[model samples]
Target: MQVKTDFNEKQIQILLIAEKLFAENGFEGTSIRTIAKEADINIAMVSYYFGSKEKLLEALIVYRTSDLKIQMENLSVENLDPIEKIDKLIELYINRIRCNKGIYRILHFEFSSEEMEEKMKILNDVRDRNLKSIETIIHEGQAKGIFRKDVNIPLISPTIMGTFFHFSMNKAYFKKLLKLDTDEAFENYIQTTFKTHIQQTIKALLIYES
Candidate 1:
């Protein structure tokens, strides 16, 4: 996605290589030289673009979520009701997870707690913006008398996110346990059954009670 603007072709190439490397080798394990060599660019070029390996990893996270921000922005202006927007938001995550499972895998598994705070420091702006975007939608629903004011976005956001995340992070075990026959069947389950479950849970959590 959005990944900020004005990135040149070479910068984009290095970022893509860094994403694949970071996903394969964990953040601490990946090196600047490794990315430079893999991308067939000079070490100085990598530094010129991203400064440090840590910064490059931060860029990767930004690159992945750029389009997501765009999608959310688009949805904000649509004529859909707040409830419909919530469903659309849920669909956006599920669909993105289905299509780019590895990106999600990289995001979920690559961060160790010690450096998570540091790395998130780099990503905090994007993270906070996305959270506030969701929170704004919730407040709109509350004003419309559709969503419960008691619902907490911080808890509810992670709940919705974690449901998909936990499942994806352990999808192999989940598929085997559920006796799914093939990858296609497993994907179908996620897109339909799991997606529906997530939608229902969010709806239940936010629905105004009498």
Candidate 2:
């Protein structure tokens, strides 16, 4: 006898199709019928499982956000230096976007959606949590005279994040601009350019403090 899996496959199928549809079409553009058609399920099953379209979208966002939170948690920052922490954050952000192309694409595409006003509120909370972690590391480094105390925590946090964002945001353009299609070339770009920018920024901010 075969043992049954925990999550219902039918529910999983609904979620998978819904995620892709919402990603491709903004939340307002997606509909229950479209999701049902995409999932090859009865239209009524959509309402039965998710209650409403809004709830379905919320579920999809929560699922993706959970994955991101898990990835953020996996980086061991307790014993690392400020610069290393920044590097780890960078690596994590890049890898997260690279690995989950669908989610990142959806996020970028929906960056300015009207629905995002509410979503941004949730993101701000997550960003605040992540920023606090980074802020603590910066403070520790400042105490050790390794990082400049004058550096703006808010500015620094977003600046460090901007590198990964820019890379992923303009991935297609950069890929063509550099004419480097291979993975080795991309790794070199991340290491040489991306890493250099981060290290140099830190050094510039910290090295001159008395």
Candidate 3:
């Protein structure tokens, strides 16, 4: 069966080019005409498909976040022990940044905008559901006696995210700190550290390693 998607070739190209431009330049720096030219499409087509320049930016943000949500959704810890689950979380975190470097750049660079405050409010409306998913996984691990019941998930969830957050959020600083350029080397550091830290975190939590 053939499935229909929201965008056809041209619209997707518009979005792809817009995202790159938006990431390179701030919202104020990018313009609809510029995006149309970059996409090699008619300026009227950009408006026809996306409504307005602001709507196009909103669409780009949605596209980025929805992609992250899909990746998070695809993750499974159903049969894995808590120790393994933690390791999986680490792997997912590092792998996500690796795969979505451009989106990560957008999140890192644009999240501070005043316009994004309202958009973040909308995304925050789903915060409970997202946090609960993490809490449930943590509690399940505890119930199985593979994780510390005393562990504070409220603390841990943010902590795990912080690990990835710092690596991504402070990427420019780290590029200089580590004397590295490009996302690939940054990813290598993450992969190396995740292996070390995940092993240690799980060992400390579970007490016995198998």
User: How much is the lDDT of residue 80 in candidate 1?
Assistant: 83
Candidate 3 clash pair list: none
TM-score of each: 0.88, 0.71, 0.70
TM-score of 2: 0.71
Model 2, residue 66: C-alpha shift (Å): 2.0
Give the better candidate number (1 or 2) by TM-score: 1
Query: 45, model 1: CA deviation in Å?
Result: 2.0
Ranking by TM-score: 1, 2, 3
Rank candidates by lDDT, best first: 1, 2, 3
Worst 10 residues of 1 by lDDT: 1-10
Which predicted model would earn the best TM-score? 1
Please, what is the whole-model Cα lDDT of each candidate in the order they appear?
A: 0.79, 0.67, 0.66
Q: Over the stretch 91-178, how does candidate 3's per-residue lDDT look in tens digits?
A: 6755765676665566556667676757455334334445665666677777777666676666554565556666667789987898
RMSD in angstroms between candidate 1 and the native structure over all alpha carbons = 2.7
Worst lDDT run of 10 residues, candidate 3, spans 121-130
Q: Candidate 2 residues 18-98, lDDT tens each? A: 778877886669889999988888889988876777656555555556656655555435577766766676666656655
